[model samples]
Target: MKPCPVLSIALALALGLPVPARAQSAPGQGGPTVIRARDDALYRELGGQEAIRRFTDDFYDRMLKDARIAHFFDGINAAYLKGALADYFCVSAGGPCDYDGVSMHNAHAGLGITKGDFDALVEDLQQAMDAAGLPFATQNRLLARLAFHHRDIVTR
Candidate 1:
């Protein structure tokens, strides 16, 4: 039995790649029509590299100002953090970039991050996306993908 296209798409997403196209039977018994999932171009829709940089910058700015999560970044270099995050987010969003930073688990290993902290950070990120004028749906799509990393992010 052949696997469903949905499964294929899920597999691609799990691998951090673009969603695969699905073949659906056309009307009137015509040949199958290719249905390309919007998720495949999510990185581009999120405005590619420059947009990710701006979004990352705004996010860190808010994070630094927010008392709830500010201490987590205390004494950290903002410029370097922003660049590394831009690369991380770009790759996570299926953009044309590679992330060479430490793994999420290894990076946050001893941060003592709690669920509340993670949730608050997510809130800050959403606000940053809002400030950047990213469409709500697109923001949610990206957030959903990021949410999958929660296990690796929160150690407390």
Candidate 2:
């Protein structure tokens, strides 16, 4: 006789609850467990490289037009900026791309970037993510990773 699917699932869940192993061992006997890295959900969610490219383009376009952050980007080559952004995003989303751009501390070292400028850029990024139809959790995760570098990127 076969068990009902729901019943089987319920039983599995109930029996799978965490329990101490029966093997005798000294305290702290387990060796360090190596965790395998999971595939990047961001890449899957953003539809991969092409989508990342498009999003970077749109994000920079908006930044150039927005008065709030335009001054910070002034005199910066748009093509270079776009390429750098693509590289950053590609690495950020766990793609195989390598970012050869300068580190945040070196890139903005003398730029005197302020908190307001950083905030504006983040806002624009959020807009770009939303425009690309990214899920809220994915957007937040990406942003959180970027946010950690704010101290290095923002001089003021």
Candidate 3:
């Protein structure tokens, strides 16, 4: 389904807000060009902060109920996890949310999180995004941002 017109406009504004000069990109030859901060287009496309919060909430709810990944959440504070995820997504999507959670490395350190578990988490997140009816581009954008943290979160 097409996004609502109002959301489309908010996305544009959220992404088009002037970024700092240091965050600007220099012209480069072919291949992917990197922007210092989060991509505004992707952020706007994701429907901004409220959408992110909804996505995170739904994602965690699914994770908690899924037998495949529920074990990983054992002993973890569900509320705290949800709050941290909200903050993380907020920052990751170029919103104004502040993430005060421990660095990914430190947070997952000694948790014995294997690559398989990490992949499962990604799959579940994808499922959650799809269930939320987000566009594919927005899903990919969020996934790409989260993928960078795998190195720090996965011990194996």
Candidate 4:
């Protein structure tokens, strides 16, 4: 059976090493081409479902304490928000999970999010990761992926 991508990544990240890669040689080529075997390293590095859950919890906790972004979540359902965020991060990090949430634009629509708000959210996430003991490189990698959605998420 093919190994789960997360399993492979889990080993590498847990060992304090970079995610494993592979090299392929062309039939007539003298050199091998290096390539990443899986794009799900971020998901695995985040420690799968359990770790993601913890991270999400920490993120919300941090966000709630941050005056800049806390008001945006007023009266919101925390459980639902965390679940959706986990699913979104799972898919964004190439994990083997499905995200059924609305598109970034649709989700933030009518919320009047601004660039400052977006930056605050990112900061909150970083703090959450730090609290969760995620490696700085790992945190950066995950944030980079999430940053791609900022353009769609911030419309104010």
Provide the lDDT at 109 for model 3. 77
lDDT of 3 at 55: 82
TM-score to true structure, per model: 0.74, 0.73, 0.73, 0.74
Per-residue alpha-carbon lDDT of candidate 4 for residues 1-156, written as tens digits (9 for 90 to 100) = 432323323333454432334333333332322222247878899999778988888898899999998999999999999998887777666677666556666678789998778777777777788788887677767765565455667788
Model 2 Cα lDDT, one tens digit per residue, 1-156 = 422323332343444322222212223423211111134565667778888889899999889888988987878899998988887766665666656566666677888888778767766776787888876566655565465456677777
Candidate 3 lDDT by residue in tens digits, 73-144 = 988888899888877766666665566566676678788888667766766676777888887667655666
**Worst 10-residue lDDT window, candidate 4:** 28-37
User: Candidate 3 overall Cα lDDT vs. reference?
Assistant: 0.64
Task: Itemize residue pairs with steric clashes in candidate 1.
Answer: none
Ranking by TM-score: 1, 4, 3, 2
Worst 10 residues of 1 by lDDT: 29-38
Per-residue lDDT over 1-156 for candidate 1, one digit per residue giving the tens place of the 0 to 100 score: 432323333443465532434323344432322222334377888899999999999999999998998999988988888998887677666676656556566667789999878867777777888889887667766765565556677888
Deviating ranges (above 4 Å) for candidate 2: 1-38
